[model samples]
Target chain A: MKIFIDPPNSLILFDLVERFGHEPLSVMATIQERVDNLEIDMPPMNVTLTDVKNGLKYAGIEVPSGIRGRLAVWGPLIDQAEAAIIMEDAPYSFGCVGCHRTNLLVDFLVRKRKLPTIEIDYPRTEEDARNMVIRVKEFLEGLK
Target chain B: MVRETRLVVISPLSEITPDQITRKVHSLGYEVTVKETCYGAVLEGPPETVSKVMQELRALDPLGIYSKIRGFPLGDPKRCRAQHGSRPGFSQLQTEWQSLSLVEKGLECALRGDKAEDIDIPERIPVKDLQRFCEEVE
Candidate 1:
């Protein structure tokens, strides 16, 4: 199963999903593809003009480019996802730290997909941590 | 060459202890610094050495030991939870650490050729129910 994770770049979620025998659809793979292509823009800034055009498919022209740019990357992943894991209230550094608008948009889009999704709060305590894992494990295992 | 840092997490079901893993990592004589963590150990050194050390460590228990590159190097004061009141991504790491045992269990099951069974999960609330709850709150 291809699982889309919110924050798009969370290593924890990525690793866990992969470890549990599912493919994680993360921004890293998308960015890596762009980076690897010499024809595209260079590292640290891999977006091509086509990506900007792709953004229009997800948002209106009036919306900020950053949000659109992010959706261009994330929207497709959500569409491809069979399931999703969304970590709520994570610190800015936990994953994609760019564009709060983009984050919210991504979250709303994933939830709207109505896929087999697990929305978990960022754990602040050891007990919360344990429960978070158990819930994630259960959710992933339950998926066909 | 740029130095690399990695967090190696051992499964709770693993026969090797963190302390034993730490000593084994040290015995490898790599230029790496090993720090035994509650979950496993953190290794900091040249990329090649870190990779080599991690490979050997994983061999100890193929399905029980896992590692990932850490964004920050060990003892990076600005990002260290010990120095700073709290590290930016420490909570995520903590949560991940706690989950390693569950991952180990799943891996073992796969190794034993066991089929995945459906586990009961909480169902999401319907959109209408959520809207009604919000309206009542208001």
Candidate 2:
């Protein structure tokens, strides 16, 4: 199963999902593909015009390009996901904190999909960490 | 040729000391800059050198040591926890650091070829029950 994690770039979530025998749809893998593409000159700065247009599928033309641009990257991943794990109340640095609007839009889309999902809080203590891993493990195992 | 930075975390359950990691890295004589942290050490240098250092570091304790690429370069004041009181992700990193012991245990179990049957996970609440609870709260 492809599991979509809220903070899409979280290594902890990525590692846990993969360790539990599921693929984690993460930002690192997405961005790495774009960066590796030779056709795009100067990489991240040079978002192909076509890529910007692709955002229209998720957002209207009137929406800010930043949100659209983000959607262009994340929208497809969300569509591919069979399940999702959301970590709530994470600090800004926990994952891609580039655009708040994109985060909200992505979250709304994930829930709207109505897939098997589990929302967990960011662990602040050792006990919480233990519980977080256990819940993640159980959730992934259930999917099998 | 892109330079890179990486965070290497040592599991709390491991007997390896941070000093041991620091000394071992320095002994390798790479051009990498190393910052010793509470969890482990941060390395910054050419991607190849960083990768080499990580390979050697992990060899010290394969299951006990873990490494991940960092988004920022070393000592970037905007993201440095020391310069700015607790940079955006430091708390998350700290919290994750606390959980390394559990991860290490899981890795050990995998190495021993054991299943996760030992863990006692409770029965999950059905979606209908959760919806009812939400409706009651509303």
Model 2 scores a C-alpha lDDT of: 0.74
lDDT of 1 by residue, B53-107 (tens): 8779978988778765564557755465676666545565665566566556655
State model 1's lDDT: 0.72
Best by lDDT: 2
- Candidate 2: stretches off by over 4 Å: B1-8, B12-138
Candidate 2, residues B16-60: lDDT per residue as tens digits?
888888899999999988989888898888878987898899889
The CA lDDT of each predicted structure is: 0.72, 0.74
Model 1 chain B is weakest, by summed lDDT over 10 consecutive residues, at B110-119
Best by DockQ, which number? 2
Candidate 2 retains true contacts at a fraction of 0.12
Pairs that collide in candidate 2 are none
lDDT per residue (tens digit) for residues A13-132 in model 1? 766676566877877566544544657643344665678789998899999777777788778899999999999876555433457788888888888989999998765544455566
- How close is candidate 1 at the interface, in terms of C-alpha RMSD after superposing the true interface residues? 6.7
Stretches of candidate 1 above 4 Å error?
B1-138
Encode model 2's per-residue lDDT on A1-144: one tens digit a residue.
999988886657766776677878876556545654667774433456677789899999998987787788788999999999988776556334567777888888999999999888776554555566677787888899
